[model samples]
Target chain A: MYNDIIIENFSDPQHVGDLESADIELEVGNSVCGDRIRVQILLDDNKISNALFRAWGCATSVATANIFCDSLLNQSLDSVCQRDVEYKQQMLGELSPSQHHCMDILNELHQLLSEQRVAEDVANG
Target chain B: MDRQQLAGYFDYNATTPVSPAVAEAMTATLGQFANASSNHAEAIRNRNAMQQARVSVAEMLGTSADKVFFTSGGSEANNWAIKGRLFNHLNKPGHIITTAIEHPSVLETVRYFEKQFGFKVSYLKPQSNGAISISDFMAALQEDTQLVSMMYANNETGVIQPISEVAKITSARGIKLHVDGVQLVGKRAIDVEACDIDYLSFSAHKFYGPKGVGGLYIKENNSLSPLIHGGGQELGLRSGTENLLAISGLAKAAEEAKCAIAQWDQHAQACKHLMVDLIQQADISVEFNGDTTYANALSNTLNMAIKGVRGEALAVLMDKKHGFIISIGSACSNNKQKTLSAVLLAMGLDEERIQSSIRVSFGQYTTTADIENFVTALNQCVKQLSAMSFAS
Candidate 1:
C-alpha cells in the first residue's frame, strides 16, 4: 500500500538514530496502534544542524519519520515548526486514507519542539 | 535471475501452480466449446466429460460422484453450504456453531445469517496449540444448534482440526456438519464417509488444479437451498453452466494428486526438515508459530517468528533483495487490516509474536536446495532487519 519512495526510505532510512548532544529530543507513540517515534535535533545559530529519528511501526510510519527528519536538515527551527498540513501532504505524496495518520509522528515532533522552545524562552526571561 | 523465477515460492497454501497434467487437460478441453447443458451431441460429450471429472473429484475425497456439486471455488462452496442450509431453514430459528479461525467465506456467511436471519452462533476458540478442544466444542453445543462449520486444516498455521471427532458428536446430536476441506483434500487422505461429514468444501487451485472451479460434497438425504437459482445445473443445487475446461483440469490434478499423495507428503516433510536444519545451523533465534512437530499439522507448512524482526519488513526484504517469497499471514488477510492474524490471536499469541510471524509453505516441487536457498536468504534478511531494529 506504499509508494516507491516510501518503500525505498523504509528499507534504508537515511536519517535515523539519536544525536547524543541534541538540543531538542522528544519521543511520541500511539498506544492503541503500537507505533513509536523518537526525534532528535541539534541546532546551530537557530538552524537545525542535524535531525534524526527512530521509529517502530509499520512501513508507512517508519518511512514517514525518516522523510520528516530528512526534510528538516539545515532548515531554521522557525520554518520547521511552521510546516503545516500541506507541507506534510507534499512530503508524503498521495497517501491512502488509512495511512494519513502516519504523518502524525511529524506533527507530534513539531509540537514537542515548539514546547521545548517556549520553555527555553521562559527560562531565558 | 528475474524475480519470478528467482523467488523461491513458500506460499503453497495461498495457491499452487497448475501442474502439467492439469494444464494439458485444460488446454485439450478448451477446444470443446459446446455448452454442457445443450441437447446437441457435442454438448453431450461435454456433459459426459464433466460427469467423469466429478467422479474423479469424488474419488479423491473418497465419496460418491453423485454427492459432489461443483461451484465457482472454495469460497462459493463455503458460502453456498452455510447460507444455503441456513436459508433452507429460514422459517425455523436456530443456532450455529463454528470455530473462530474459519475462512472469511464461512465467517461472513454465518455473520450474515446471524444479522439478517437472527440465527444465533457460538464461535469456538482454539487452544494454545491452535487446535479446538473437543470438550470446548461439546460444551458449546446446544439443542437449537442446527449446524457446525469448521475447517479440516487451518490455512495459516496448517493445524489440522479434529473434524472426524467433531463429526461424531455433531452427527449424534443430529446437527449438520460442514468442513472447509480446501487445505486438507489433496495434501492428505480424506474419507468423507468414514468421517461422516455432512458437507465439505474444496477448491481445485489449492492442489495444482486450475483456478475458478471447485466442488462441495453433500451427504445423501441432506439438501441446501440453492445459492444461485437459474439453469437448474449442479442438480439444482448450484445453477450455472459448468466450467468444463477447469473442471477437466481439476479432475486430472485430482487423479494425479491421489496417485502421488504418499510421495508428496514425503517430499514436503523432507523440505520441512531441511528448513529446520538450516535455521538451527544458522543459529537464528526463532520460534515456530503452531505445532512444529507436524503431528497435527501439514508437513509442507512452517509458520515461525524471527526474534527482533518485523515480519512485514522482513518479507519485503526477502522478496525484493533476495528473491524469496514468503507470507506474513494468509494472503487474504494481509493488508486488509492493520492487526495481526486472527488465527494467532485466537490461539493466545501475543502481539509481538503475531507481528513477527511469517508463514513458509512448500509443495511437491519444492526441493532441498530451494529450502536451503530460502533459509540462507531468510538468515541474511533477518540479520539485517534485526540490526536495523536494534540500531533504531
Candidate 2:
C-alpha cells in the first residue's frame, strides 16, 4: 500500500542543518509518526525571498520539505501578502484535504511569511 | 551466494512446521471424513476418532478427555476461558489478577472484560527477571477476586511463570486459575489436575500441528458460560461444527510431542549454547533482558539488547543480506504502532534498551548451523550499524 513512499531517506537531506540562523522559525508536524519539519523563512520587504527547511522524518516529509523550498526561492515579497490570494494560489496549487496533514508544513511556511509582513507593517507605523 | 544462503527459523514459540507424522495422520483422517455430530454408523466412527484424538491431547496434558474443549487456536481458546469465566461470574464482578507480560490473547481479553463488564484487573508487574512472584499475586488477591490468570510461558521472552505455585494459592483461597499455555504446551509437561488449574489454553500450530485448531482444558464442573452460544458441540460450553480433521491432527501432534519433549530439550540447549557464545564474543556491551537462570524461560528463546545499534535497522539488514527472519517483538503487536515492547517496560528497562531489544526464539527444527549463520550475520550488521551511527 505504501510502496510509492517506500524510499528510506537515511542520509541527511538538503537544508537540514540549523534554524538557529533563521529570523522567523516554524516547527510543523510531530515526532510520534516520525516526522518533524522546521521552516526558516528569510523575509525581505514583506515578501519571502528565501525559504529553507530542516526536516527529520520519513522519505515523504523530507521530499515534501525539499519541494517546498524549491517553490519558495527568489519569489516576490508580495507573494505572501494576506490579500494576495491569487499569488498564493499561483505559488501553491490545490491538494487533497488529508494532504494538509503534510501540507501543514507549507501552511506554516505561508503563515510565517504573513507574520513577518504583519510585523514589518507594525514596525514601519 | 543467494542460493547458498544459510536459512534459519527462530520463531518456534510462534509456530512450527507440521511434522511428517502429523501430516500423515491428518491425510488418513481426511479419507474417512464423516460428520462427528451425526448419528449414522460412519458418524459414530468419526466421533470415535475425535474421542481418541481428545484422549491423546488429554494424556499429553495429564488431564481427562471430558475437560478438553477445542477452539480455532490459542487466541480463541484464551477468549473462551477468560470471557467465559467472567461471563459466568458476572454476579461476582470483582477483580481479576494477571501478569503484565501475558500474550495479548490473555492481556487484551482481560482488558476487554474490564472495559465491557466493569470488572477490575490487577496486572501484576514482573520483576527484573520477567517472572511474577507468587507473593505479588497473593498480595493482589482480594475477597471479590474471582480469577488469577497467568501464562505458563511468555510468548515474547519464553519466561515460564509458576502456574503450579500460583494455582496452589488460588485454589487454597477457593478462587479460579487460568493458564495461557500456548508456548508451554509442547515445550514442557502440563497437568491441569496436578496443578489445580481451572482453565488452560493451547494451540496446535505451536507444536507442529495445523493452524486454526487448539483446545482449552477446563476442569470438570468448572463454572464457565459458553463464549459462543449455539448447538451444544463441546458439552454446551463451546458451540460450532467441530474441525474433526484438525482435531485428529492436533491429537497426533500432541502424541508426537509427548514422545519428543526429551529430544526438543537438546535442541533448545544447543541453541542456548549458540546464544551464550554470541553474547560472550560480542565486542559492544549487550545485556540479556530477563533473568536467564531464575525464570523458567525456554532455552530456545533469547531476548538481547545491544548497547548502541538500533534493532529495527539490524533486523532489516539481517533479512536483506542473510535471509535471517526475526523480530523486534511479538508479531501480533507489530501493528501500526511500533512500540518499544510493554514487556520490557514492565520489567523497568530504560527506553534505549527497549528500543534496541531483539527477540530470537527457536524451535525443535532450529539447528546449530542456523544459529551460527545468524550470529555471523548479526555481528556484521551490528558492526556496520555502529560504524554508520558514529560517522553520522
Candidate 3:
C-alpha cells in the first residue's frame, strides 16, 4: 500500500549511511515502537554541503529519512530551520492510510532538525 | 513494475480464505432468506443449516449439539461467555483468573470488569517459552474466584496452555472455567465434556469458514445470563436471527476440518520445518521465538527474530516489494494501548527480540514452494534492510 516514491527509495536509498566529519547529527525516535531516523550533515559557510541518513523503522520511515536528507543538500541552516507545512506535505508524498503514521515520524524529524538552530546559535554566539 | 502483488499468503492465523465447499454452501443459501426464528416451512429449512452447524461443532468439540450456541463471531461469543456469567454477580463482585497473554476479547473484558465493576482480576504471566506455568495458575486461584478465562492456544505464538490440568482443578473447586478456543478449534480436537470446560468460544473464519459466524459451548447444566435481550434464540443466551448462509459455511468447513485435522497437522508441520531449514542455511543470524514444538505449541506457527531487522519494516517490504504477506505479530498486536505485543511482553521478552520479531503462520493451503519463496524474499529483504539500518 505504498506509493512509487516510497518503493523506489526503500529499495535503493541513496543517502542511507553515516557521513564522515559532519557538522550536525540529530536523531528522532518513536517512543512507543522505536522507529528512528538519524541524519548527519556537513556544513560549508553555514550551508549544507552533504547530507546522509540512517534509519530503522517501516519502509516509509526509512524512505522519508532519505527523502528528508535529500531535500537538505546545498541548503542553508536558516532555510532548513524555517521549513513549514509545505515541506512536510512534500516529504509525505502520497502514503497510504496504513502507512500514514510515518507522517508523525517525519514531523518529529523535521522538528529535531529545526531545533538544530539552538546549537547553531550557541556556536555563533 | 509492482513486484509485490500478493504472491504468497502465509498469515493464516489472521484469517483463512473460505474453502471451496464452504463457499459453495454459502452461495447456495444466498437467496434463501427465511428467518430461522419463524415457524414456517421455509424457516424450518433454513434452520437446518444452523442445526447442521451445531452438530458439526459438537462433533469437533466432542460434546452434544445442544451445548453449542451460535453468535456473530468469536468476540461476541467471548463477551457472552465472560459477561453472561459475571453479569449474574452484578450485586457481588468476585475474583477472576486469566493469563497476561489472552486475546483482547478476554483481556479487555476482564479489565473492564476490573475497572467498571470492581472485580478483582489476577492476570497470570507466561514464562519465557510463552506458556503459562501450571503453578502460576494454581497460585492465582483465590477462594472467591467466580471464573477463570484463558485461551486454548495463543494466536500469535501458537503456545498451547495446560487447559485440561487447569480444568481438573477448577472442576473440583467449583470455579467456572471459560476457555477462548478460537485458535485451537480447527487445529486440535477438543473434548469439552472430557475437560469439563464450563464455557468456550470459537470462530468460523479461523478454519476456512465464512466470517461473522461463531459459537459458544455452554455445559449442559450451566446457566448464563442473557447478553442480548430479545426473542429467545441460541437457547435464550444469544438472541439474533441466525446467519443461515454463514452457518452453512461454518458447518461444511467444520466438517472438512474435523476429518482432516491429522493430515493438516502433518502438512503444516512439514512446511514449518522447511522454513526452519531455509532459515538455518541462510547466512544471517536469527533466533526463533516462542515455544514452537508441537507438544508445546502448534506446528503451523513460527515467530522469529532476525538480527537487527525491524519487523514492521520487513513486513512492509515483504508485502510491498517482495509479494509475501506476514506480520510483526497478530492483527491486534498493537491493540490494548500497547504498541508492542502484550503476549511477548508478558513472556518477559526483551525489547530487541520483540522489535525484531515477525510471525509466519501457515495452514492447509500452504505448500513447500511458498515457504521457499518466502524465505528467499525474506533473506533479500533482510539484506536490504540491514544495509540501510542505523543500528545494524
Candidate 4:
C-alpha cells in the first residue's frame, strides 16, 4: 500500500533534492495525479557517479523517489536504465499496486536515457 | 496520529464506525446461524429474525416489509436495480434519465448498460445549487423512457435532489423511479410512499453499521428480474446464504439511527457551525461549491475550494503534520488522483476552483475541539502552501 511506502521512508533516506548539473535526467508522474519527480544522473565515463532527485508530492512519493535515486548511483547507466528492474524490486521490498506508480520516475529515466544513447549514435554516424 | 490511534472521526459520509449498540445486537444474533430458507425449526427461527429485521428497516423508510430486499452494499443494489430492469425490458430499447452528479454506482451502471445492453441514458445537469430542475427532467422524458435513477442526496456535496417532483413526473409517465438513497436513508426522513418510487437502494455503513449490508426497496407492483440467482435466497432475486451477522448489525444500526435522529441533527448542526467559524476566521479566497441556503444539502457537510492550493496536496499535508484526515472526494477514487471531481464539474464550477476543492464531512463522533484544532492547522498549512506556490 502507498501508506506502507510513506511509513518506511518518512524518517531517513540517502538522497533528496536535485543535482546541480547532470548528464541525464528522468521525469515521472502525471499532472492528473499531482505528484511529479525528476531523477538526475551524474556520469563518470559511462558509469553513473551520483544520482539525486527532487520530488514534489505526498510523503510516500517523495520518499520513494529519493530512495530510488540513492539505489541507482555507482551503477553503469545502461544497467540502471535498460537492464535493471531490480532497483524498484529492491526499494519497495515488495510490490504494491497503489505504490507502483511511485516507480514511474525510474521507468521514465530508462526510456529517456535509451533515447539519449540513440541520439548520440545518430550524431556520431 | 497512529493508524490505530482514534481521533475525532468526522468523515461519516465516507463511512461510519459501527455503533456499540448495533455491534451487540449483531453478536447476539450470531447464535442462530442457521440458513433462513431451510425447513427445520432453526431455519424457521432464522427466517423469522430476518423478516423482523426487514420490517424494522421498511418501517424506517415508511414502506412495507415485503418491499425490502437485502444486498451486499449500495453499489450492488443500484447496479442490480438499474441493469436488471433495463435488461428485462430489452424487447424495447428505452431511454433512462438521471442527474449528472450521481455516485459512481449509478453513473457507471448507466455507462455499462449503454455499452453492453444497448440502452441510452440522458444525464441532466444539476443547477449551480446542485439540484436538478423538474422542468428539465420532464423535458428529457420520452415515450420509451423506462427508468429514472437519481440519488436522494449527493455523496460528494451532500446536496439533496428534487426527488419528489422527479418521482411525480416519472410516475405520471408510468416510468420506474430508482433512487440511490445511500446518503439520505438515516440522515434525513424518507417516505417512499409519498415519493412514489418503484426502486431505492441504501447501505448500512453510511448510518453506522457493518460495511457489507445494504437493501433494495422494490415496489410489489413493479415486475423486475433477478440479477443474481442460485440457492434462491432473497426470493431468488439474490443467491447464497445470508450474511446474518451483517444483516443483524444493519438492523440494529437502522434502529439506532431512528431513535437518535434528534441527536444526529444536533451534532450535524454543531459540526456545521465549527466549519463555518473556521472558514470565516481564515478569510481567504474560498467558495462553497454547493447551495448554502437550500434544504437539499446535509448541514454537516462542506465542500470548499481554498483559493490557490491543490486539494489533494492540502489533504496530504494535513495527514502528515496536523494528524487530520480530510478527503478530496470519495475515498474509493481518491487514489486515482483525478484533478477535477466529475460532480463538481457537473455543477459547472471553473477548472481552477475544481482543482482546489476538498470535502469535510462531519460524523456522530466529532467534537468542537477537533474542529478548532483543524481550523488552526488548516490556516497555517494553506498559508504556507500558498506562499510556497507563489515563490516557486
Candidate 2 chain A lowest-lDDT run of ten: A1-10
Each candidate's DockQ: 0.27, 0.07, 0.42, 0.17
Clashing pairs in 4: B160-B296
Error of 4 at B74 (Å): 0.9
**What's the lDDT for candidate 1?**
0.84
Off by over 4 Å in 3: A1-7, A21-24, A30-32, A42-49, A74-79, A94-125, B1-7, B329-338
Instruction: Pick the winner on lDDT between candidates 1 and 2.
Output: 1
Backbone clashes, candidate 3: 0
**Model 2's TM-score against the true structure:** 0.77
Q: Write the per-residue lDDT of candidate 1 for residues B293-367, one digit (tens) a residue.
A: 657999889888877776877787787777677888421122234666889989988888888889999897787
What overall lDDT goes with each candidate model?
Answer: 0.84, 0.74, 0.84, 0.77
The worst-scoring run of ten residues by lDDT in candidate 2 chain B lies at B329-338
Error of 3 at B78 (Å): 0.5
Candidate closest to the true structure, highest DockQ: 3
Clashing pairs in 2: A47-A77, B10-B361, B72-B212
Strongest candidate by TM-score: 1
Decreasing DockQ order of the candidates: 3, 1, 4, 2
- Which residue pairs in model 3 clash with each other? none
Tell me the deviation in Å of residue B90 in model 4: 0.7
Q: After aligning candidate 3 to the native by TM-score, how far in Å is the CA of B284 from where it should be?
A: 3.1
